[model samples]
Target: MTDLHRRNPYRLPVLLLIALSTVVGLSILWEFRLEAWVMHWLALPYDADFEDAERWRFVLTATGFSLISMLIPTIMLRRLIANTRSSYRRLKQAQAKTETLATYDSLSGLINRRIFMEMVRNQLGLKRPAAVMLIDLDHFKAVNDQHGHAAGDIVLVEIARRLEAIADDNGGVAVRLGGDEFCLLFLKFKHQTELGQIAEAAVFQLSAPLSSAVEPSALGATIGISRSWTDAQDASALLHCADTAMYRGKKDGRSTYNFYDSEYEKQRRAQADLELALRRAVEADEIVPFFQPIVALPSQEVVGFEVLARWPKPDGSTAAPADFIPVLERLGLIPAMTRSLIKQACRAANRWDDHLRLSMNVSAGMVTDALFPDQLLEQLRQEHFAFHRFEVEITEEALVGNLEVARQNLSKLHEHGITVALDDFGIGYSSLYHLTRLSIDKIKIDRSFFEPGQTDHLPMVEAILGMARSLKMQVTAEGVEEFHLPHLPSWLANSGCNYAQGYLYGRPKPASSLFCYTHSSFAQQAG
Candidate 1:
C-alpha cells in the first residue's frame, strides 16, 4: 500500500463511504413519501394545491438533515481512524528507538557487546583471515575519580570517535565493550603487519591529551591484536586472545600494542587460575603473615618485625608475594586482604615483647581509602595491640597519584601513635617530595643500594642516611645478606642507621617460629 493508505487504512474510509452513499440514496428515493407522512403525522397542511417552491424547500431540507445525521458518524469514525494510525506509527518509531538503544552504546554510539559479538561470529563463519583487537584505557578510573565522571565521559566519547573514524577508514568495525574497554574487528587484513600498524595508530591517537571541562588529562591506550588464522577459529576465543594480549600490553606499559603469543597466553591462563585460587585463599584465611626481624644495627638485636603475606599451598609450598600482590591490587582485593592480614599480624604481635614493634606493609588502595586509618586502629584495638608498637610501611609508588590524600592518611596514623615508614625509599620519583610532605617516621633504604660491587651507590646511600638523620627519621638498611654483612662498611653503623633487615638477619618466619625468639635471652645472644 502507498504511504497515505498505510497511515489511514482504506477499510474504515470505504465502510463509511458505503454507509453514507446508501443513506443518501434511500433518502432521495423515498423523499416525497417520507415528507408527506411526516406532515400528516404532525397534522400539518399537505394540500394538493400547495406552492411548488414551499414543497420543494421542505423536501430539500428533510434530505439535507438526513445526510448531515449520517455524515456525523463518518466524520467521527474518520477522526478515530486517523488517531489510531498516528498512535501506531509512534509505537513503531518507539520500538525502533528501543532496538537501536539495545544495539548501540548510549555514551559512544558504538555497537554494543552483543551486536559486536554477533558480527564476530558471522565473520568467523566465513573462515577467512581477520584481526581482532582489544583496547583498554590505562588509569581511566583515576580520571573518573579525580575529575568526576563527566570528564571521564568526555574522554571516552573522544576516544570512541577516534576509534570509529580509524575503523571506518580501514573498512573495519569498532565497538565499546564497556567502560574504558573497546574492541575493533577488521574482516579484511593482508598481514599481521597491517594489523599491527592499525593498532599502533589507535594507540597513538588515544595517547593524545583529552580535553575536559575540569582539566586536560593525558591518557594512553593499550591495544591487543589477534589474528583469526593464527589465534582461533571462533569469536569468543579470538576475543579472549585479544584480551590476553591487551593485559600483556598493559603490563609492558601502556600506549603500545602486543600480538597474541602462545607463551603469553599460557602465562595468562596460569595467572587467571592463580587469581581464582588466591581469592579462595583469602576467603579461607589461608593467607598468613610471616614476620622478618628488623634488628638494631651493630648489636644485631631484634627490635621489631616486618609482617609479610604468604600464601601457602596445600602441598606446603608458598606462593611469593611478588606473584600474587599485583593480581590482588588489579582486582581491587588488596584492601580486604590487607585488613585480614593486619588483624592477624596484630594478634600475633600480642605474643611478642611490648618494645618489639610489628610493621605491616600497606597497599596503595588501603592508603587511599578514607577509612583506612580508622580501620587499622579498630583492628589494633580489637586485638589489644599497642599503637606505639605498630608501624605501617607504605611504598613511595603508592603515594604518587594522590599525595595529599595519602599524606592526610599518614598524618592520622602518626596522630594515633603509629609509626609510618617509607618502604623501598629512594626508588620512586617522588621520594624526596614524600619525605618533606608526609609525616614519615622511618625510611627503609632499598636493597638495590646494598648490592655488592656497587660502591657507586654508597655515596647515595650515605646521602639518604644524612637526609634521614636531618629529618630525625629512623633509617633501616635492607637486603643485608649474610655474604654482604662482613663487607659492610663502618659508615653504615656509624651514620646512625637505626635498623637493618634481610636474609642475613633471618628469613621471614611464621609466627610459631618467631615465638621461639621471643625470650629475652635470644636478644642477649644476638646482641
Candidate 2:
C-alpha cells in the first residue's frame, strides 16, 4: 500500500472516500433503532411504536441518500485531482525541454560552453583534480571550402558522436565549444599520464574520415590538455591554458596534443606579437622583394634573378624569411603579401634586359586560389611585363592541397607563356610524383644534396639530373655556397646542371644592386 501511495500520489482522495462511506453506514444504523433508545434516555420524543419492517425501510432509504450526497463531491474531487496531476506532468516536461535547450548544443547534442563551464566550476569547488582538453580540427576550412558547409556539418556531427561515446566510456563530459572546436572534461583524474591517454584516444577518434555524401577526406585534430591542480584552479584559467597548448600543437604541425607549459605560453605570446607586426608590415608595404642572381653554370654569367621577400624592420635591419614567412602563411597573409611583392617584382623586372628572366616564389595559399593565374596575368599586363621572361617557382609543399587546382593553375600559367619550376626538389616524398604530374619546365635541386660529407646524396643528384635530361627539363643546382672550393663548380657543371644560385655568387640584394651587378658582370665578361 505504501509503494502504491508512493507511485500514485492521488491516493489521498480514495482514502477519504472509504472513510466517508463507513460514516454513512453508521448513520443509517443510528436512524434504524439506536437513535430511538438514545432519545428515550434523554427524555426526548421517539417513534418506538413504528413496525420493524418500516424501520428497516427507513435504514435503506437513509443509506441511499447519504451515498448519493458523498458520490457527487467524491467525483468532483477526483476530477480536480486528476487535472492537477496532468498540469504538474506537463510543467515538468516543459521545464526539461527548456533545460535541454539552455544546456546543450542544438546540432551536436553535446553540452554547450556555458553549461560546460558550470560543470568545471562545480568540480573545482569539490577540490577534485581534473583535466580539461581543447580540441581544434585541423584544415577544417579546407574541408568546408572543398565540400561545402553541409558536408562540413556532417563531419562535425560525426565527430561529436564519437566524442560523446568516448566521454561516456570514461565518465567524462564532452562539449561543443562552437565551430570546429570541442572541449572534454575528465573528472577525478589520478595522473597526467591518464589524461594524456584519453587525449590521444580523442585525437585518434576524431581523425577518422566522416561519413558524408560528398566523399569527405580524412580529418585531423590537435588537442591541448591542462590539469586543474597543475595548470589552473579555475574554469577560465584552465580553458585558457588548454587553448594555449592547443595552438602550440597546431604550430608543431597539428594532429597531436600538447600539455600546458609556461615556456610554451611565453613563446605563443611572442609569436602572437610577430603575427600582429607582420599584418601591419604588409599593410604599410614594409615587405619588399630582394633579387638574387641566378647565374649560368661554368661561365658564371648572370642569366636572371629570383625574387626573395625581406621584411625591413624599423632599425633598417631585415627580418629573416625563415622567421616571418611561416607566420605569414599561418595568418593567411601570404596571398596578399605575394600579390604585393609580385607587382613590385614585375615592375622592376620590366626594366631589365629583354633576354633576362625574373622568377618569383608562389606561396601555397596563392596556388590554391582558383583565380590566381588570371589575377597574376592581369597584374603582369598592367605592368606591361612580358610573360615569356617570367617564371613562378613552387615547392612540393605548395601542392599539398587540391592537386587538381594546382595543376589547373599551372596549366593556365604555361598557356600564357610563363615558365613553372619545381623548387627544393629531393626534400619531399612526392617530388618525383609532382614532377611527373605537373607541367614543370625546371627542377631546382635542394641545398641538402650539396652539403659537404653528404656524398651519399651525389648519386641521387646524378639520378635527378639524368631524369631531368630525359624529360627535356632544365635543372638548377641551388645553394652552391662552396663555389670558391677547387673543382666544386666544375663538378656541378660537368654533372649536367644548367643553372646555379647561391651565396657564392651574392646574397639577395635590392633590385638596384642586382641591376648594377648584372651590368658590371656582363661588361666584364664581354671585355
Candidate 3:
C-alpha cells in the first residue's frame, strides 16, 4: 500500500528467481564444479543433451517455482504476528481485573477488610498517633422493619459511599466489613469523624443530607477508636483492639464514639448485660411513670404536674433518662413506654381536681400513630380530664419534619380541645417560623435562655415574644432556679407569656406532698 511496500512487494521473489536462473545457467556451462555435478546428477546414466533449449527452460522454471513457494509464507506471517500481540494484550487486561477484585469489597466496592488490615500492618512503622475507628449503624434492624429490606440495602450502600469519601485520601482508608458495619483508618485526627475537613469536601456531591434519610435521630453515627499501645504491631491486633473499643461506644449510648479504656471496657461489658436485662424489663412491666408537680411561678401553687418515666431497678437509686432513653429507643420499647404512660397519666388526671392539668412528654411521632389517637381518646373519656387542660410538650427540632402532616394531626387533637405546646422554642433555626404556621397554643422558653452571664439575646427574645403575642400564644419560662430572673413578668405580660414553671417557684414534688401545699396558697395564684 505504501511506496516502500509497493516497491519491494516482489523483492524476495525477484532475488530468489535471479539466484535460481544463475545456478541453472552455471550448471549448463563448462565450469569445473558445475560440469562435474551436472554430468553426475542430470545425465542419469543416459547421454543427455548438454544444452537443450527446452530442457534448459524446464530446469530454470522448476527452480524458480521452488523459490516462489518459500516466498508465499511471508504474507501470512505479518497477520499472525498482529493476532498474537492482540491476544497478549487481552490476557493482561484479565489479569488486572483479577488483581482489582482481590483488594476491593465485592459488596460496597470499597477496600475489603483484608486489604485494610494489610495496609495497616504495612504502614504501622510510620510511627504517629493514628486511630482506627469502627462504626456500626444504630437501629439498623428497625430501619429494615420500617422501610423494608430493599430500602435498608440502599441505606447501607449510601453509607458506604459516604464513609469512602471521608477516608479516600491522605492517611485515611475506609473499609467495608459487610452489613452496616465499617472501619475508618484515621491517618490523622485532624477533624471530627464525618463532619471534619475531609468529609466536608465530599458532602457537596450528595443530593440529600446523608443522615436524615436513614433514621429518626438523623443518621447519627457511633464511633469507637483505639490507639496502638505497642511501639510496633501486626494488623490483626490493631483491628481487634479497635473493634473492641467500638462495641464500648455502642454501649455508651450510640451516636457517639468512645476511645478505648480498660475501666470503661469493663463498664461497657456490664452495660451490655444491663441493656439485655432492660429489654426484658420493658416486657415485664418493670418500667413505670412518676409525676412531679409544675406549680405556678408567683404564687408557688401547684396547678399541674409533669410525668417522668422511671425504671425501678433493684438498686435503691433510679436510672436517669439520659442513661436509658437511647437504650429504650434502640430496643424498640418507645411504643410500649408511650402506651404505658398514656394509660397511667390519664388515670391520675381523672382523680385530680377538675381545675388542675397534666403535662406528659411524648415523642413527636406519637401524635400521628393510628392507635395513639383512639387510645388517648379512650383514656381522656375514662378520666374525664378536660381536653383543654392537658398539654403535650415537644422540642422545636421535632416539629421541623413533616410540618404539614403535623398540622393535620394537631388539628385532630385541637378538635378535642387539647392544648399543644412547643418545648425548647428558641433552639431550632426555624422555630419561630414553625410556631406561627402551626396552630399551637403555647411555647416553652428553653432553659438555656436563663443561664447566668449569657447575653445579647434580647432582640431574639423580644422578637419571639412579639410573634407569640400577635398569635395570642402563651409563653412559659422553664429552669429559673436563681432568685433574680432575667426576663420580667412585664415583658412576658406585654408579650402575652402567662405561665412560669421551674425550681424557683417550687421543686417538682410528688402529688401527695404537693396537694396540701397548693390549695391554701391562693388557689394556684395568677401565673
Candidate 4:
C-alpha cells in the first residue's frame, strides 16, 4: 500500500485525540472563572440553586448540547486537515512527474534538448572544461523502412542505453536530441585528446550491430566533437560547430569522427549559399537543356542528341555541370529539373529530323522512385513526344543500388517503347549481371575507356563490344574527341560499337544549333 493508504488507520485516532483535547481545555477554562465571566456578561444567576433537580437537569442538558456541537465541528476540521495533507502530497508527486516529462525523454530517460542546453550554459558560466559530441546514426531510416517502426524504436532505445553508459563512465551527461540524433556533454574532460578518445569510443560502440536492425551492416554512427572554450563561446554555437563537424564526418564516408574546424565551417557556409542560389535558379528556369549529337558509328549520321544541363548566368557565361549537378542532387531538385529538361529537349528535338532521338540522364534516386516512370511518361505525352524518340540514360550505380526498383522502372519504360541505356558501363561492379538480367536496349561505354593513347582499354572495349553483340544489345562508345577519330571510329565500328558521341562531333550547344548541326557536312566527314 501507498503511504496515503497506510496513514488511514491513524485518521480516526487523530480525530478522537483532537476532540478530547478540546473537551479538556474547555473544562479547565470553565473551572478557572470563565463560567463566571460568561454568566456575568449574560446577566445570568451564577449563584442559583444547583441542588434543585429541575435546574440541574436544565444545566446538564445545555452542557450536553454544547459538547455535541463542539465535537461535531472538531471532527469535521480534523477530516479537512487530513484531506488537505493528502491533496498536497498528490500535488507534489504530479509536479515532480511533470518536471521529469519536460526535462527528460520519455523513451530514453535521458535529458532532452531543453535541459541539456540549460546545463551546458551553467557549465560555461562556471568556466568548467567541457566538450560536446554530436552523434548521428547512419542509415537509421532503413531500420524503420524495412523492419518497421517498432524495431526502429527498440534500436533507438538500445542506442540511448549505450550512450548513457558512455556518459556515466566519462563523468558527463547523455541527451536525446530527437530522432536518431544524440548528444554527449562532458564536464570533466581535460584535453582535446580526451574528447577525441571519447568520440572514437562513441563511434565504435554505436556502430556495433543491433539485434533489432533490419540491415545490421547499416548500423553505424558519425560523431563530431567540439570543445566549449575553443569551438564556441555559447551553447548553441557549440552545438552548431559539432553539427557541422558531424556532417563533415558523414560526407567523408561515415563511421568516423571529425573535430570542429574553421575551414569546414567556411565550406559549409559556401555550400549553403550555393544551395540557396541553385534552388532559386531551378525555380526560375535559368538552368536549361543543351544538346550534344550522338552519331551512328561509321555512317556518322546523327541518330539523336543527348540532353545536358547548362546554367546560363547573368554575366552571359554558363556554369559548369560539375559545379551544379551535385548540388541539384543534394537539394532533391534533380527529378523536377529532369522533367523540365525532358519537355524542353523534346520540343527542341521535334524541330530536328524525325529520326533523331533525345536522351536524358536520370539519377539513382529518380530511378528508385516508383512514380518517376509514370511522371516521365506524362511529361513526354504533354510535349507531344513519341515514346520511341525518348530515351533514358541511367548509370550502372543506379542499377546496382536497387535492382528490383530499377527492374520495375526499366520494365515500364521498355513497355512504353522508351529506350533504356546503361551509361558509364565499365566503371561499376557487376556490370555483366545487369546486362544479362535487365531488359536494357543499349550500353554506353564510359569515356574513360576512350581516352587518347589509352591502348590498354582497347582490349576491355573489345570485350564489352563482344558481350553486347552476344546479348543482341546496341553499344555506344563515348568520349570520341578529335584525337581518337578518324581511326577510332573505324576501329570502334569494326569492334561492333554501334554509336558514338564526343567533342569531335560538337560540344553541347543551344536548341537553335541542333538542326544545323544534324545537317552539317562535318557530321558526315567525321565518318
Please name the candidate that would achieve the greatest TM-score relative to the true structure: 4
Each model's C-alpha lDDT?
0.83, 0.85, 0.66, 0.85
For candidate 3, write residues 1-527 as lDDT tens digits: 23444467776556657876766566446342355566688765644444567556766676566556655665565466557767888999988887888888766788887787777766676655456777777777777888888778777778788777667654677888777778777655343444243433432322235453654334456665665643125567676666676677666676665665667656767878988878877777666666665655455456776777777688777776777878888877787776666666666566667667777776766654545656676777776667877877766655666677677767677678888888888877887677767768888888787666564665666677777778888777766664535455334445455676665556544334434333644334433
In candidate 1, what residue range of length 10 has the lowest lDDT sum?
516-525
Clashing residue pairs in candidate 4 (N, C-alpha, C atoms within 3 angstroms): none
TM-score of model 1 relative to the true fold? 0.64
User: Can you give the lDDT of residue 333 in candidate 2?
Assistant: 90
lDDT of candidate 1 at residue 105, scale 0 to 100:
97
> Residue-wise lDDT of candidate 1 within 387-411, one digit each (tens)?
9999999997779768889999999
Candidate 3 stretches with Cα past 4 Å from truth are 1-265, 296-300, 368-371, 382-384, 454-460, 485-495, 516-527
lDDT of 3 at 94: 84
Give the Å error, residue 387, model 2.
Answer: 1.7
Off by over 4 Å in 1: 1-62, 84-115, 126-130, 133-189, 197-223, 250-256, 279-284, 293-306, 325-339, 349-377, 387-506, 514-520, 523-527
Off by over 4 Å in 2: 1-229, 243-259, 272-284, 297-299, 313-317, 327-334, 351-355, 363-370, 394-415, 422-475, 482-498, 512-519, 522-527
The lDDT of model 4 is 0.85
Error of 2 at 407 (Å): 6.4
Clashing pairs in 2: none
Error of 1 at 59 (Å): 3.1
Which pairs of residues clash in candidate 3, taking residues 3 or more apart in a chain or in different chains? Answer: 223-257
**Is candidate 1 or 2 superior in TM-score?**
1
